[model samples]
Target: MATIASQIILHPVVSQGLKFGGTTLGRDKTYRALQYFSRFFAWYLINKGDKIEAARWSALKAHLGTARKLMRLGKPMEHLQAALRAAFSSSPALETITTIARQLGYFGYLSYDAIVWASTIKLINVTKETAARVQKRAFQFWVAGIAFSLIHGALKSLRLAKESKALKASKTWGEKDLAEEASRETRVAQITAARNSNNAQLALDIFDVWIPASGAGLVNLSEGTLGIAGLISSLLGAKAQWQSVNGKK
Candidate 1:
């Protein structure tokens, strides 16, 4: 029994999980996954005529959302810094513009979202109408950010595709040029990886966009649909973050 316990304590998965949960973002992702699951379960319960259970799940979802808002209190400035960095990046003009726009949109969304949070907690009293307006504006900015992100992803994918094709078409003279060919192959591989990452992000943004659009009254997705979409996007984000934390490709 002692040997089994020691082995469990020293397991690699256990260690990696601890490392993952140590970061703020990792914790938020976990919460988000739970939150969205709650949302979906609440809807399912309601359809089954279980009002009490549905109410409990709904409350859990709301509380988790409030916790996430608190966690992101100072995050707007991070988006602002990202915008500035994007402005100075050596990307093409359209990509740079879209990237900066996306970051700035996030900055605006988070700034307004902070105000909504403060009002919710009674840190500063705002009328219900005002709070609703602010929330709508925040969701609007979120939609814009996702739109720009999709554009950026499309442009990046196109650029990477061209680069990959060109690299593949390049000819090597002989053994002397073998090293250059190998270098070209490496660059092509890097491009492919980057394209895959971009594509994944694009899919995540696509799934996420509808939730904000519904909030902004631009669309009317069912609660269950929004819940499932949010869950999928959160998992995608968590996967990317996990790879980053573990130094994996």
Candidate 2:
């Protein structure tokens, strides 16, 4: 909601040492400009690209550039910082610009999608291979989001239907066992259906994108990224196995 400049100023302090894309940043006098640059990239990707991830990265680069410039110029610009801050605050159009400036930390602010795209953009202008990897990773992130969303929706729907039936029968049911008996078929059905539909490949698609890359990066869970994509894959693979067993019943 805040303007670009305000986001730059406010975010660094408020963001609380968030990290991703191989950078450590903050709201201190030094980190302010870089904050704006990253935010600008977020703003750009959010609006310009057909994909939400692309636009977000664009916005991030924009604000980060601005904030970085200001940080470099750091002479005696308390007044200038104040002015820039106010300009964004007064202008409604600068809303997205401002929000991007505030910056986001990995575990704290950056979402899974933003983190993936940002990593990809870091690949840009770096090397052909890196760019390719970034693109691949971003794609996997999208697929993961979509896959999770569909399954999540289905699960929620099943839950609501069960709850509604229980409520409707609340007054008439004498035994708790009756309620359990009534819901048993639906639960079994939902779980069985989910398990049957679960493909190990489908569940682990996102993880596959990162496994080779993680190996190439040489992190091996030692540093940089916690290899989030890899972690997700491992968990999903385990779930798929669990689902297979459940589906048999």
Candidate 3:
């Protein structure tokens, strides 16, 4: 990525006909530095609260100030021209910095229960509201996963049993033929059950691990969306479990 940045900084002749208050800042090495400084300054203004952002801005400003002093510029135009050149030239760097800052900010702002759960299952120990919310979400994911598995398992088992009975009735089968058909059906049923279980496990991992870790940041979707989804899945899973329990009774 740094190599990419260097390539862009060197190759792109972004600085063209650049003038600040009638003072020409020609496209050259100095001009590129000036551009970088200016762009960094703008980025600082946009993301000023963070300590790192402030420190970087201060360093960049000081460098530009030092350059100004060395140039012995009495006119404001000379300083303005230099600053403008830096701002325009440093766009690539500024964009990269901004993106990184945003990701860091998002990480700090969000709660991730997966980490907490991995460390320990004691959700009550986590005091933060965000942590609590994340724990609830994780639990919902588990419940949903279970609910789907139970309901799906029951339905699929019933379906296979019915199909087996039908096959037996349709065939004038000897004991050996009936036994072979039953074995084949059992194998099919086992494979299907395993596949469905794996699917449920995948769903659980997505909601519990993937979403909390990084997926949330990548999508930039509202946290409320996850909350709503968690709620629905929890309900479905609970209902399925309840029905299964009642059916067994």
TM-score of each: 0.98, 0.25, 0.28
lDDT per residue for candidate 1 within 1-249, as digits (tens), equals 999998999998888888889999999999999999999999999999999999999999999999999999999999999999989999999999999999999999999999999998899999999999999999999999999999999999999898888887885678989889888878988998899899999999999999999999999988899999999999999888888887888
Off by over 4 Å in 2: 1-126, 172-249
> Which candidate's lDDT is highest?
1
> How close to the true structure is residue 224 of candidate 2, measured as C-alpha lDDT?
17
**Hey, what RMSD does candidate 3 come out at?**
26.4
Error of 2 at 186 (Å): 22
Clashing residue pairs found in predicted model 3: 34-86, 35-85, 35-86, 35-87, 35-90, 38-87, 39-87
List where candidate 1 sits over 4 angstroms from the true fold.
none
In model 1, the Cα lDDT at residue 203 comes to 95
What lDDT does each candidate get? Answer: 0.93, 0.42, 0.43
Error (Å) of candidate 3 at residue 111 is 14
Task: Put down candidate 2 lDDT per residue, 3-26, tens digits, no spaces.
Answer: 987888668434332322113222
> 125 in model 3: Cα distance from truth in Å?
12
Is 2 or 3 the stronger prediction by lDDT? Answer: 3
